[model samples]
Target: MVEPGPSISILAGGVTALFAVFLTFYLRNQWQEIQSLRAIQTELEQNNERVRELAQLLTGDLQRQQIDLPIEVPPGTKLEIRYVVSFPSSLSTTAFDQLKHSGMFLRLSPETRRSLFELYDTIDRINRLRQHRERIHFDDIGNVHVVIDPSELDVEPDASVSEDDLSAETRRRLSDLREMRRAMKGVNRSILRLIASIASPEMIDDLELEPFLGTAHGREAGHESNTESPRSDEVDLEEMRSILRDVERESVWSRFM
Candidate 1:
C-alpha cells in the first residue's frame, strides 16, 4: 500500500510548516499596518477637532464685532461677487455646480434659508451613505488576479500519487491560504475606503455647505499626515473664480454669462 519515494506524511508536514510561516508573517505585517492606520486616524480626528475650534473662534469674533459695531455700507449697497471654484472632473464636482447654480449661497428670504439648510443636511446624509458603502466587506471581489508559478515546482510521478494520501494536510493548507487571501482583501478594501473617504468625489459639495474644506489648518494637517492631503476633498474656490474671470475676459463664457 506504501508505494512512494518520500513518505506522504513527512512531505505534508513540511508543506504545513511552510504555510504556517507564510501565514504568520502575513498576519504580523497586517497587525502592524492596522496599528499604524489607527494612529493616523486618531491624528486626523484631532486635526479635524482643531479645525472646528478655529471655525467657532472665527464665527464668535464676527458675531461679537457685529453686535458692538455694525458694518458700514454705502448708500446703495448692491454688492455682487462672482467666482468659480475649480474641481477635478468628478460626480462631486457636478453636484457642487448644481448646488451653487441653485442659488444656495445667495442671501435668500427666511423661508429659503431654511430650505437651503435642509438641502445641506440631505447632502451630508448622502455623503455618509457613500462612505458606508465604501467600507470593507469580507466577500468583496477584486478585478486583479494573482498567478502562481507552477513551473517552479519539481513534481515527480510518485509525488503526484502520494498527494491523495496527504489529503488532510493539503485541505488544511488550502483552507488557511483562502483565509489569508480573504483577510488581505479586507485590508486592501479598508485602505481604499480611507483614501476614497478623504478624496471622494461625492464629498465635493460639502465644501460649500458651511465650514470650507481645506483651510490653512487642513492643509497643514495634510502635509503632516501620511494619509491624505488637506485639500484632498476640496475645490480651490478662490482660484477657480480667478481662472473663470480671466476666461470670461477672453470671451470663453461670453455666450453664457
Candidate 2:
C-alpha cells in the first residue's frame, strides 16, 4: 500500500489549492461589490444634483407664474404661448439600474431603499407630467398663438379663456406646473436626507449640499422678505406686460424650432 504520509500530503495539497481558488474568487467578488457601491454613491450624488437643478428651474417657473398671475392677453397683441419643455437629466437611472441588477441594492438598509424608490417614483411622475403637458400644449392645441386684435383686447376675454377658468388647458398646464414644483421641493428634501444618511463625510463635503438642506428656515425667510413687499396692481400689470413683450420679442417657438 502507498505510505499513509504521502497520501495525506497529496490530500493536504489539493485542499490548499481548492482553498486558494475559493479565496481568489471571494476577494474578486468583494472588490466588485465595493466598486458597485462606489458607483451607486456617485450616481446618487449626480441624481441629487439633477434634482436640485430641476427644483431651481421649477422655482423660477413658479415665480414667473406668480408674476404673471391672472394671465391676460393684451389688446392689439398676438399672445404666442409656446411650449418650451425641459427634460430632466438622463443620468438619473443608468447607475441605479446597474446597482439593482448587481443584486447589491438589496444590501442597502430597507429605509434607504424605500427612500430611493420614492425619489425615483417622484422623478418618473415629473417626467410623465412633462410629457403630457408637452403633448397637450404642442400637439392637441397646435401653436398657441392667440391673436387679440385691438378690438378683442378691450372686450373682456371669453370667460372660457380666462386664466381662472379651470376648463382652459392653459390653466391645467399652470396647475400641473405648480404641482410639479411642489413635488420637486419634496424630492430635494428626500435627496438631501438620503445623502446625509449614506454619504461619507468627505463625500458630503465635496458635494456641498449642506447649505441647501440646512438652510430651510433661512430660505423661507428670504422668500417671505422678497414677496412680502406687496406691489400695486399697476406694478403687477406692468410686470405682466413686460413678460408678454419679452415673449413677443423672443418667440420661444422660434428658438425651439
Candidate 3:
C-alpha cells in the first residue's frame, strides 16, 4: 500500500533546531531582498525612459554634426565640444552586488534569476558603449589638430564637407547608439516585469514562502506598467532622421552592441 523509505538516523541535539533557525533566517533575508529588488525596479523604471530619450537625442546630434568624428576633420579655429551622456546618479548596484555575491541569488526562481542577470549585463554593456563613444571622440581630436589646416570650418575645410558624407566608422557609431537605446529600454521593461512577478510569485517555493512572509506586504499585480512598447520594435529611418540636429551640446553621443 505504502512505499517504504530509508530509515533516518536522528540528527544530533541542536542540529534540528539549528536548521529551523537557519530556515527562518533565510526567509527573512529573502524578504529583505524583495525590498531591495523593488528599489532597483523603481530606479530602473524612472531612468529607463530618460536613457532612451537621451539616446534618441544623441542620434539626432550625430546626424547634425558637420563632423561626427570617426573621420578626419580640418581643425579650423572652430567650436569644440565634449558631449557626455548622463543618467540619474541615484541608481546603484550595491544591494544587488551584495545579494548576488551571497547565497541569495540561488533563492530566486530560475526565470527570475536569469532576468536579474540579463538586466545587469545590459547595464555593463551601456557603460562600455559610453566609454567607446568617449574614446572615439577624444582619441581622434588630438590627431585632427595635428594634421589639418585651421582655415576651414570643417565645412570650409578645403571649402566643403566630405562628398562621401558620414564615414563608415560614423555610421557604425550611430547604429551603436540606437542599439544602446534599445538596451536601455530593455532594462526598464524587464525590471518592471520582474518586480511584478516577484510581487505575485507563482512558483511552488514562493507559495510556500507565504507563511513566512505573512507580515510582509506585497505589491499589487503589475502585469503591464508601461503601455508603450519598446522602441526596438521600430526600424524607421525617416522618422529617426527627422529630429537630427547639432551635436554641440552634452545631450548626444551613441551606443555599444
**How many pairs of residues collide in each model?**
1, 0, 2
What stretches of model 2 exceed 4 Å from their correct place?
Answer: 63-86, 101-103, 141-257
Model 3 residue 62 CA deviation (Å) reads: 2.8
Ranking by TM-score: 2, 3, 1
What overall lDDT goes with each candidate model? 0.34, 0.47, 0.39
For residues 183-219, what per-residue lDDT tens digits would candidate 3 score against the true structure? 3333333332222222223321432323222212234
Worst 10 residues of 2 by lDDT: 227-236
lDDT of 1 by residue, 1-257 (tens): 78575688789899999999999886665444333323333433443343233323323323332212222223223222111112111112223334334322242346433433433333343334334323322124322222222222233333322223334544354344344444443232332223323332333343222332342335423433242223243322222233333433444223332
Name the lDDT of candidate 2. 0.47
In model 3, where do residues sit more than 4 Å from their true spots? Answer: 1-31, 68-92, 102-104, 139-257
Candidate 1 stretches greater than 4 Å from native: 1-9, 61-257
TM-score of 1: 0.24
Provide the TM-score for each candidate, comma-separated: 0.24, 0.46, 0.37
Best by lDDT: 2
User: Using TM-score as the measure, which candidate wins?
Assistant: 2
The per-residue C-alpha lDDT of model 2 at residue 115 equals 56
